[model samples]
Target chain A: MDDKVSIGMDSRRITTTQRETTRPFSLKRQPRLGESIIQGFLLFCGVLSMFTTIGIVVVLGSESIAFFRQVSIVEFVTNTVWSPQIDEFGILPLLLSTLLTSTIAMFIALPTGLAAAIYLSEYASSRARSILKPILEVLAGVPTVVYGYFALKFMTPVLKAVFGEANVNIYNMASAGLVMGIMIIPMVSSMSEDALSAVPRALREGAYGLGATRLETAIKVVLPAGISGIIAAFVVAISRAVGETMIVAVAAGAKPTFTFNPFEAAETMTGHIARISGGDLSYASIDYNSIFAIGLTLFLMTLGLNMVSRRLVRRFREVYE
Target chain B: MTTLNDEIKSGLPQGEAARRNVASRRRTGAIWRTIFLSATIIGLIALSLLIYNVVNEVFGYVATEYAVDPATLSDKPIDELNKDELVAVLQDNMRANAFRTLERDKPMADRSESEVYDLVIERVLKPQTLETWTLRDSWFNKAAIDAQVASEFPEAKLEFRSWLTAGFLTTPMSSDPLRAGVRTALLGSLWMIAITILFAFPIGVGAAIYLEEYATDNRFNRIIQTNINNLAGVPSIIYGMLGLVIFVRTLEPLTSGRIFGADSGNGRTIVAASLTMMLLILPIMIINGQEAIRAVPLSLRQASYGLGATKWQTIWHHVLPNALPGIFTGTILAVSRAIGETAPLIVVGASTFIVTDPDGPFAKFTALPIQIYNWTSRPQPEFAHIAASAIVVLLVMLLSLNAIAVLLRNRFSKRG
Candidate 1:
């Protein structure tokens, strides 16, 4: 069936070209078995994406309704404490922790990622770019689980050594957030570099022609031109940082407390879901449904960020064209 | 504009001022260049540090002492014991029900004498990990390690163990970090990847075909395109939620295989996880497929039509074959991304530890990332060592898959 559809779909390109040359084409042609099959298959595939969106919404909404029926939506959203074990289902604690970790990660990722991007775009020779890009990609490809392990085993020990044992907790958010920042560096760098390179050489030449230094030109001209794409990278990286699970699961303690300190261990939304799902919860329990509510919240946050990213990417494309 | 040296020195803007301008600009450029180079260096250093950290734990000397040496149980060497003798050793040593449980998990009748003997060694003659040394310390301080072992643990065995052994890849997860291996997890990962590819590939390609070839530029198609792009960036854990409510609960009868009497009726089966992964990666697959198809040149299609072949015939003969290589590259990358994905599987109920290999699509499963996560969560130092080794396995798989992607992309780019 797949082969037949591929053949059918590819063959259509030929017929369109043939029709243009032949002239006087009529719309009322007899339907064929093969053409109909290909069309049906393609349409089915396209519509399945819509089905996936519906599946996500229906599943999340139904379970969230069950949760909100038992726990008020206003409380779930506004309450500061999140002790499901004690029957207090406040989401603010988890939301705050997620924000804290993502913020720390961005603080660490943005300057380094942007600087690396600028370096690659404006300074590196082609040979240097070729060698460095693939290596950076390798860093991106390292599994998050490995990063989690590195956070727990390596980074924690190093931090303890630096701050003294009394200052650092075994499962602090600092290590997880820092390691996650490292994991996203390549992602931000490559993306911003892509944007920076797309900034027309004419702009850079115009700056240089006016007696501007390379530093002045890159900072004043290219950075401003690629600002939308750089912001998009930041949003995408933040979304990724918020959604990361294993690093926080292994290093950041599953305490889920509302706190402003980065050194203390606290659960993010993804970590909470992983922690709850790993335990054996009986079917249809409120605990099970609570993860769904959290998931719904998480889904909406990422969706908004992704839409912003998409808009930014489109703006970046429009700048040149 | 020519000026005397005295005028320029007195700060008239001329040759000296212009030279200073050029020199200062060059200085600024050099400073920025150094800064950029350092940024690249910092990234490279971090990457190297991670690899170094993982590799540092894969091989080391472990000081171990058994409760009762198997050597004392039999006059003959433990490995040389006959099947009946090994069974006698196990029965004599282990509690009756514990023996039964082992047999229940994997039947004794099916295992070789060596296999049962190894189990006896693992379960009955349990080796307690006394002290551990990192790969670096074990190499440089071998004499000190030996002296400490001799003073503290006279009866203990001090041996260098490479955690990534053939047996490690062949054995199952265990409570003891020394005996724990990744056989079950490896199989689960392979099963999940297989099903994900099977489901996502055809559907993703079909969608790309429709969008690139058949669909007219309209509101609906534009909306579909936007949704696909957004879906590509959706947090993977959200997909886990979708899968849990859809595959694991709502469609349990279908996913668990209870309708066909194949599963034990547990909704959190390999089939459910695989399907979740399929959905998670479908957007990436569709976008990649479109890119590959769009790369096919228009001249090929026109030439094929000049020969009077229909659309499908032209696609099959010219455009698709050219696009196929690029498509493979994209699929390979998507699969790599899917395999490394831990968040979705964790939410979809990947087990922390499962000792038995999965029986089929509907069987319970745990993957390598989950195992690595589980091991790292344990407080024991030895488990951290094992976690490091598991990371080596995961990295090898990810790198090889990505290498294939890079090679295929280069191959296709050359041809196209």
Candidate 2:
């Protein structure tokens, strides 16, 4: 339809006189009613994103409210146990596991990811950086489910060997945390590298003039300058780690425990949701609603982290500019 | 000071303290640099490890013992046998109830040659896997494996089997790992991706056009911009929750094919999964589209305007064509993500063990990643082997799509 209309328009236009004028200025084409329709359509499409947000909030809010009615929000927030199969509505255990996994992941990812960023920005030759950077991103391109299997088959066994098989369970948080950390390394490195490279070269030259070596300048001057970006990277990576599902589901068991021991098995919020939903549960069952309730918590947590990261990035940009 | 001056005048070496300081500082620098280098290499290591681990699981040797070898019965090459012949073999060999139930579940008339063979192998012979070893271990430790197999399962026959075989690809999901395949999940993934692109592409491009060309930098535009960036960061599992509530529950009539009067009227269908994926990739698509459109040279637009073309006409004729390749690059990346994602579908109720292929948007579905996840989580090690095979398929699909995008980007760049 569009092609036919366009073709018709091309034939109807008289080309003889229009081509004669090599006008310096625009000829002021008449604003047709069709233009307004197109504009409206475009604007409507843009507004769909906003509708998506509203949809998310409304859906989560309505279901979460229903969940709250069945289980008190205060108790859900404060209670320590999360045995939903037996009617315990404590959100603490899952929250703890989420926190524990994210913390361990951050610990592994932050320093190593930052070091890689520093290397790419300040140390690696241009040729090497070009070759290495995309290879690093291939890690990000990998599906999370593959990482889950890795954690299950490889990382856990390696951990078992290190910690002794008796100490590390077949399904444990250590493997999940380490693998999750590895999963987010590209996010941290890529973002931090961008921030690191954005720092003025003049600052490094100035530091060098003061007799600081490359290592000294990078750690003291460049890192400080790009600290906000690094922080933003950390926040975003943590948000990613918190929401990660399959790694924890496959490697980390479904048992929700309050213990923070990395060797023990635990379930994350996303893990719990995957497990419960995989089975047959009728609509509006408490078991069914609990997943939503857990999902709502996860949604808010990631949202908060994202907002913080955004704010940090904006602040850093403002300061630099 | 006098001694240092005398040494300098005589062209002598420096003292121990200064030499030690220089050596120590250089050593520290080397150490830190090595640390950074190691850190950089970790990503590469992780990628290799992932590939190695998944591929390692794909091919291997398994020790299997059948209840009754088909050779004991009449055999005119089982492969050449008709479906009826295979069914008769199953009926004679297996109990009446099991055979009848299997036939009643999905009629023998509909079953293909391979399916009949799979049924025969799975039910009649009941070739139970006694033990298994990876491809690497199987080759190097052939004698050891043979000894172990002899010791463990004396009656078992050991065969070098590539888990990702033709039959594995052709069969449907089954309770027995040996017979299970990704046929249903692959169809679901393709269908879901098709629907996702259909819904997201036009809308995403329109949004990009509005943001890049039409909208003024007013507060409303700023809000929309901020909202998009924020949406891109939202966890995909959250999108699943939104999908479960909105598409699955709230929009059941539309999503479940009830309105269209199609069979399999369930909200947790391909339509819902597709819509969820559409939401998941919508922000990414819009952002990439905006970048693609924004990259079109301003000179092109100016020339079009100078020729008396309206804004939309200039965009449609000149700007869009220029941006189309970039748009395609981004769309490919988004499509890969949509195909690989499992968490959102799991939340939106993609079945763990679906057998039948998803026929349409409103049919119940299971994607490749969901299948992989389900198989991996099973206690049976055989399931993990098949899951690895599925992962290989999924990765090939994803990486090839990305490779195409990269190629397109390169070609377009060269043209520019």
Candidate 3:
């Protein structure tokens, strides 16, 4: 039925347009009820995602509002102490521990993951690539809890042997960070590979044709083209490192302290929540509210990173495209 | 005349020419490429070894406990009455092996007390198995085995299932590794994952379609875009804390209903935990869906529009079908993360033990990761074996889910 109407319109327009001017945009006037319904559904989906953002902000924000009212911003920010007892509540120690662990995890993840990415994307043979890709993905597939258990039973013992029993605390941040880095290797490498692969082969060929080596072409032409993606990948990986909890909860002990020593036991924002929630706390209490407050902080940090990374991805695409 | 002699001398040094010849350069290039490829292969091998080590350790226990000791299994494999028959035969063989081991360790009564004691009688007299054996029954009695061991040879260390069994899935945790079960935890995981998918998929897919199709590329949309990305990165535990504060504490009035039986004082119900995870993974779903949507060729949209279709109609009729692959892929990724997550659930007060499966979404529940953690942390070494087996089960489930996701993505994209 619609095909008949379109055919009618086409014949009428063809006859009328023989002498017509200003008819280039005539197609915009068409009625498309079926099309509208599909578009409407898609729009509804998009709007719903936006609401998720709103929901997170409102729910987390409202509860955290109560927490800030109870504890002064200065005490939470300035003080290094994090007792979270009846009289004292501080977030500084948790923040510091979170930063320290994430930083350490990045330190481990960046080199190995980048190397693996380069090897896989640029150097590895097709046979090698096919076999290696799935295996490395298996690392990501293992649940963090399994990693935590392995860290406690296996990784800790090996660390103790190397660092000695006295120095290597069972719940130090290093083991957790190291294992967490291994867990996220695929994320960084996979994203980096995507970024690198998106760099035009024309650019590499141009460099090579100019007598540059493969490594030289990658370093000078291809990597620069894909720098924005690499940066995005790095930022995303950092966010992942910060968000990681199970390994930290199990391998990194739940002693919230404002210290940078990787060897010492520490607790991250997520770890604290895990520990506290595992136990009991009264509902509507200030301590419970603190969880929301910390969540708000984590949310803000990650939100900022994601936005920046997305912008970087757009800019990176523009540069090459 | 001298030029001819010089030319001949210059041409005649064939030995020097042979000595100066270099090896084929392509072989050297091939060797380098081979080395580079081998390094990548090594990385993969290391990963396999890691998995192999964990599986090997866990299964070693299974081998000891389950493997039939051919010497004492007088009946053929089919002659056994039930599943326990093989275990019984294995036990008898284990007892005989113990006697042989003891005889090697010590001599007669005058020689050593270990040698004079009965080994076979102890295990055979009282065959006690772990809850794993609850699925099976042994023919021997406890006191009888003790007396038989004392009267015969008394030098044997009894072994049950080295690894965990299905009984571990059914039993609530115990102080003893032999008695621990993950039945409650498994049920909890099911409830949590089911609720999470129900809540997150709609919101996530909706958000993806909205951002991808309808919303103009304006500053507000950009902000929303940024927010979703960041939400994906936020540590999941924060969601747990938010759930605790919002659902357990502030909203306890709604959740703490006495519908199940008693007011068991469990504040963080499965519903609350599920919502938190839903929030945590929503961003992932949106982002993945957006990518899928973006991949659909714009030409299809133009064709629909040219046929007198509205903007919405064009997207619905022409675009969405093309983007189905991305939607499924994104949904799978989001669900996978949701299933594996343990930290946030821990934060929201998943019970360490609940004898019964959760009665409803509001009922308190335990999950597999929580159960595994509880077991592994215990002082007993046997519980570690249980944890390993549980880990295996969890990995298998995750892998299967991922496989399904890949299959869907491939099937849809292939249609495109």
On TM-score, the candidate that comes out on top is 1
User: Evaluated against the true chain A, what TM-score does chain A of model 1 have?
Assistant: 0.89
Give each prediction's root-mean-square deviation over alpha carbons: 6.6, 6.5, 11.9
Off by over 4 Å in 1: A1-28, A313-318, B1-18, B69-71, B74-120
Write down the TM-score of every candidate. Answer: 0.90, 0.89, 0.75
CAPRI-wise, candidate 3 is: acceptable
Q: Which pairs of residues collide in candidate 2? A: none
Q: DockQ for each candidate? A: 0.57, 0.65, 0.37
- lDDT for each candidate structure: 0.87, 0.88, 0.71
* DockQ for candidate 2: 0.65
Query: Model 1: per-residue lDDT, tens digit, B25-134?
Result: 79988987888888777778888899888888989999999888767898998878899989888888889999899889788889987788778877788889999899
Strongest candidate by lDDT: 2
Query: How are the candidates ranked when ordered by TM-score, highest leading?
Result: 1, 2, 3
Can you write out model 2's per-residue Cα lDDT over B286-390, one digit (the tens) per residue?
A: 999999999999999999989878899999999999999999999998888888888889878898877887778889988899988888888888887999999
Error of 2 at B280 (Å): 0.7
Give the per-residue Cα lDDT of candidate 3 at A314: 84
lDDT of 3 at B199: 77
